[model samples]
Target: MSDNLQEDQQQAVLCDMCTEEDRKPARKTCMKCEISMCVHHLQAHVTTPVLLQTHPLTEPMASGAAGTTKCPQHGKLLEYYCLDDLTCVCVSCAIEDQHRLHNMKTFSTAHKELMEKLNAEQQALAKDENVSLEKWENGEREKLGSSSVRLIEAVSKLRDIALTSVQTSVSARMVSIKTSKSSMQVAQNEKDTFRFLQMFSQVHQDFEKAKAVDLRKGLEPGSDRDKLVQELRQGGEEMVAQAVQLWGSLLILVDPENHQEVFTTSSDLTFDPQSLGIGMSLSKDHRKVFYNSWLGQLSAHTLRIRSVHSTSNFQRWMVSLSEDCDWTIGLCDKESAENLKDGHVYGLRCQGNQLSSLTTDYYDFTDASRNLEDSSFGLQKVEIPKTEKKRRVSSQLIKCPGESGGDITPRPQKVEVFRNIAASSLSFFSRTGQHQRTEILTMKMSFDSSDFFAFVNLEKEQAQKSSNQPPGPQQQWMCSCGKVYIETGSGYSYGGCYYSKSPQAICSCGRVIGGRVIGDPCITEVVCELL
Candidate 1:
């Protein structure tokens, strides 16, 4: 009874070669033979060289049945493994199935090789994980320390300014008050009647002055102290907001996958007329500028955009130029734009047949012409040949003919500029097709907390024609309240009337001027109270 209980508790696997009445527990299982054997019965596999080499032995399996070892599909013993498919296969499978051309190995060899490969991979991965973790930890600490130091320095500077201003104002007021008090006391101590009378007027005047002297007046609403305080408060708030924005941008920039989305959003920009140099004319939308001719020997004029962008923001824009035009387009900080010849700026300059990087500090037309092959500036000589193509103008596709056809040859070159402030990279790309672009050059530099603006300098000829040009002389209209609305040349007026579509003009005087469909001559007459 006790032996039977012990056997049941052990749940031992009996030797498949033993008789049923005298079955013995198995020590190992031979997968090749599909049988279990006790230690005594396993000696043949251990001593026999052929069986030792061929048979694959494993710890005793509960079911060493032939059915488990046979292939499910072919009903043959699974003898080979397919390395390509990573599966066990039978002889029939190896010869007939999809595993025919795959690299095959015996089951024992495949198992041994797979185990070794897995162990090696595990070790390599462990080492890589440790190294990456250390790097991340160190980088995180460094970033935090640097940011903290900058913030502390800014705060300390602000505090010092505020304290100095307050102390200076308070000290000046206290000195004035003390001087007045001493003068009044000396007059009050006069003993002689005659002297007292003579000093009476001066004493009374000094007393009145002292009484009117209000120390708090320095901190009054319109005083310098008050203004300084307000400025400091506002400045501190702005600094905090900027720090938060910069940190947020940095976090987003850390993920490499977000880079494309971060830098691809295009900015809708217009040229600032105030910044336009002589000889440049802008389109109705202030987007396109034409260089008819230079007014002086300094033919090159830099035009800036009206909108100012933070150095930490991402900005992208495209400039389309005529093939024969010599132009420079790029980004410049506010200070650099003022003095491009002596300041730091990043851009692409195209002169004659060469396209080179535009580093403003070393910018010179002669240098660019002489050093076209200079790799330091990433200069590339490109051919800008005249090509006949259809160009879109004012919502119309104008077909430009060849030189023989007596029509203008269209050769537009579109260059895209990308500014990534987080990475401090300004990249220029040439648009090759509708959906393809080739990188022209990339300028790497550190950016400070300054405003950046897009600028363009035309050296010689005019670039592409403006797409928003009016087909004819723009019609003008006037409201009853004397608001003159100029025609936009796109069948619309500045007064919010779509003359080409559903024509209507609602005056500021609450009067509806005209409501009619396009092509009606009366519609124009009705809306246009011409100035």
Candidate 2:
């Protein structure tokens, strides 16, 4: 039984680095400095040049394994064995102060100790793995929970926009119909009055001709005829005056070359949370998270499409700002062989602070397989939206929770409301008229870092100042590479101030004039123009 157990143990000898069959005797020995060696380090000892210099002709150990041993410090061979203190020391270290204080030892003793310590560490590490696994699993669950919130909000907002659009269309149509009816009524009344006056006037003229003929003939007494004729003339004159008044009023019913113009200004969008940084929470519900990671470099100017299509099939637009002007527009699908062969790539270049890039097909999600390039890793999908309800013209002012007053008073300030002029399928306005149609798109953006997160609404406002005073500072401005524009007090030297409208702020570069009009100001800022 003892013999059988010894054979089983011998068969089970293993390498520290990996799981392999028991090492062969010849392969185990180090050629540079012969000594007892394990399979883990036998090859390394032989290949080391430093070990060969010290023990070029040493013999291998018998019974266990034949190999050379190397000094741990300098990788030198262990040629001269010491018997006093059991520790390995290189030739240089052997004469050092620390080693000189003790009686040095051979390589075998130190090597054995090192192997034993390594085995203990291995066992301890295995025990700790279970704890680490639990922690990792918990973290993953939290991430999933956060992303769910953002996705829900995004989806809900889309639905609300659709419903609002339908309601606005119906309201506009009703207004148009009412105006048309009013115009028709005024025109019809004027025509009726004019016809009546013309008929009466013709009768009076014939009567006058008859009176003249009778007077000339002197056939009858004139007083009765004159009285009758006078009364008839007076009635004709009254009818003619009425007709003139009615005809003048007809202008009100006419759809003249210039009509009453309706002007709508867009409302300013404000964000609830201010700034969200990387890996930050977007909301208190713990259902939203922000992630930002670097994707590979992409050549954004290559997309060329032979045919243009409607924007409905395109994906949502993503705006990233960095110091570099690399505005990227990703598509949901990659160009196939047919597309590539046909040169379906679109070229996008940076013009000042704006990016004028186009995409053959737009993409909402960042999917590399479906998209032409790898998608950003940190983008998350979430939905959390509040719906707006229509109220009467005499509606009470809106107030949030914890307000001291029952209801706040609406400010007498002029509000610029923007209308969707792009929806011309139903309405058209003359360009030269006083009132022109307008449309606006609002982008929901969240800025974040590891610990900070904020959500802000961004939209293009009409060029004219809505308030008596100039507008407040914009929330943020970014370049294509996700770089932010920083404003400085130094007149022209500052980055963003080069194009801002500050009398005190001038371009330090002296290359251009000062103010917003000096250079082409970024579209990120509100720009206004008359149609």
Candidate 3:
């Protein structure tokens, strides 16, 4: 039984570093160094200069079948890649870090996407090579071909000139040699060797003798190598320039050094909870804002996304909107969501198809529809949303058992009032599509990192019985105490509707619901809770 139990137990190798200090077990082996270390020594191996230089950190072989790869931070498996951050992260890191707000994809998916784009670039380069080469040949070939002909002619002429000079000098030298060596005893000189070899020997011997007598006096000075280099530089410049242009169009090279033209990942956008209204909660890295119940409590606050200002920051992001989304996405300053008018909408100020100010707002909001009337944000013919009933729970007093016990009854509930503040300049877009995924609006913002950005959202008359409000319509509300009542038609009337005297609703029980979303909603101080 003891032998069987021993056989059933698992075994492991001890860490080499730990064993050096004591008889400790090794957690994992460093593939680079072929040494094992305990968990403690594993960490030191990465931090200690001597150990780090000789060893690298890896997962313990005994841990599981997950392989010997672990995140440096949590010692967890790095299974996901953050597309927005461009990094590999553990499950914990993905849920807590800015990566939580970022776009994440599986490693396999990311690899596929990258390979696809790279393949696209390869295809583009192939096309460029064919088209550009053909066009360049057609345009410059006839002309350059003539130059080539001229070049060949010039080379041939130079070679001919050289051969002529060599021949004339050799003939002259031979004559001089005969005259100088006439006294030598070479009776059988005609039978010295083959005709060609004899001629070469005679010419060399004559040249040597002439040098001693200072026969040849002058030769031109030049460099064939230098001339070739100069010609190559002049002709290659144009071809190099065309290659650079084609590379820019087809290849997306990511590097900080190329920031002037490269598009890098933008920082994650999150909302400050302090900027959110009552009853709304932020979830999934502040990407979604949810109202707990259908019971509407009036609050004049717009949702905002955090702003990125650094020149290195350039990002384009899309927001998914449900078919029932009445919310708007926009850019604005801090005070925009704080200052609310009673009945006037506070978010965007949309006019026609064109937005109010491209300079002021990053963009103007518009819908993808054939007719303006069928859409909720038609500038002129604004149609109200259809009605839906919601259940409201009322608080009733409980009667304790007594001689004069009476049945408990509930009283009429007072309406709640919420107000929105006037922003310096607010911009927004209406939501559309199923799961809010289909009708995604992409916004591109490029700016210096030093500036502040505040994104805000406002759902117009959300709790109101009718959906007949304009793009950013607000409902009027008077407090139950009648102490605080905002002006009906005096909201920040920049791009929203500008009107007078509209119907007003009673405020619900005046309760000070905390301002802000549950998670980070973008606050310039901060910003992304959208209601």
Candidate 4:
């Protein structure tokens, strides 16, 4: 009895592992279902382990609708497949109007066919994805290669632009340097002229002093005085000749790169006797006076000359024209109290190709002569005539020879001494057709021009007197109206645009006007007589 009870207990435990089914034999154990069952009762078992535990059935038919197909579109069991329309259909669907044209087949056959087609479509989609991925990778590589090349080209172009900028800058600097070189040459020439003029004046002064000493001593013929006189004469001539040469003009010299000369006039233009005439006439005041040959042509005009004893001899002259002749006169000399009443001196003039004289008072030779006479007399006879002095001005810095700092050569001081002398001398009375004995002199006149003094061969003598008197060392050169120094060359300075090696850039206006450094600046005279 105990053995029967143990066998019954083992049978009960084994029965606990049966599958659920309504009506079928559970002959096999379903490993995934976790069930064990007798084949004879398995057909009615429920499908899941939970259902099997509760119902305790043993049947293959327990899995409801096993091997049955479902329709995705209708959510219904696929009872049949329509071969003509290529669709699954239930028995009810086939009888309906929607499936009327569909040919029916078992659900098992339709399921197998649908599964094969779905697998083929998935495989095709995977292949297409791989091809698209390859194309995308190639495009990325091409884009990267193009970008690298563009970057390199951009860098090279930038480098070239930088180099071009540097070259342009260098060129501009070189041009500036060249311009500076040209201006320096002009300043140098002016300074040299100043130095020469100073030297010329000293030489003339020495000659005059020597002559004065000989005259005062009144030497005997056989004595050393006679020999000294001869020596002094020769020395004086030599010194005067040197002084005359100082008046010779200069030229503007150009560099070898530009071999051009600087001046326009080349005829050695000097005071020509052909252009002037002197004659004496008795004035209404019973004074013997002088008039220019040309002055007589101005409607029967007559000019008078008069002399006054001063430190230097003071001379006065005046012109009177017929009331019919509408000729105007101007003085070319500087204006001063003494010159104002003396006379209206005429400046050099040209009309209808005939050279004449202009009347102006700017170069009032009468005043200039008065000043020179007073200055020469050492303030004894006449208080030194107050003269208008030129203010000294300087040029920009230039590299001068033997200079420590850059040289600032001053523009030459203008002295109207020669003009004054001319005014006074010309005022001397002279008789018509009388052979006038005169001394030829070399006078230094300061002129404001690109050239220095005009080397004019002027006759110095008393216009009326032929009496033998020692010529005064301080003689005057004058005009009937006034005296004027010749102004030649353009007023602008050549080679004055340059600056020197200095920290400050000098302004262009700082340059001084000067004579030409390389050419003649005056007209030549064929014949001239001296007083």
lDDT (10s digit) by residue, model 4, range 1-531 = 698975554344332244434433335443334355564434545455675544322223233323234455555555567877887576567776578666676655666777888899888878878987788667755755555455455555544544454455455445544444443444445567776566555445544543343222234345554655565566556554443322221111112212221222212221222223333222223321223332222222222121222233322222222111122222223321123224334332212112232222233222334532355657655434445633221112222235588553221111011224433322111111112211112122233322112221112223432346323211111222222112222222123343332334222343222212232211111111112
lDDT of 1 by residue, 146-201 (tens): 76677777788788887787678677667657767887787778888898888778
* TM-scores vs. true structure, each candidate: 0.40, 0.21, 0.22, 0.20
User: Number of clashing pairs, model 2?
Assistant: 52
Indicate whether candidate 3 or candidate 4 has the larger lDDT.
3
lDDT of 1 at 228: 87
* Candidate 1 Cα errors over 4 Å, as ranges: 1-25, 44-56, 64-70, 130-132, 174-256, 259-531
lDDT of each: 0.62, 0.35, 0.43, 0.35
Across residues 465-512, which tens digit of lDDT does each residue of candidate 2 receive? 244543333333222233333333332223423544355433344323
Over 301-321, each residue of candidate 3 has an lDDT whose tens digit, in order, gives 466566334343332334433
Structure candidate 1, residue pairs in collision: none
Judging by lDDT, tell me the better candidate of 2 and 3. Answer: 3
- Least accurate 10 contiguous residues by lDDT in model 2: 448-457
- The stretch of ten residues in a row with the least summed lDDT in candidate 3 is 410-419
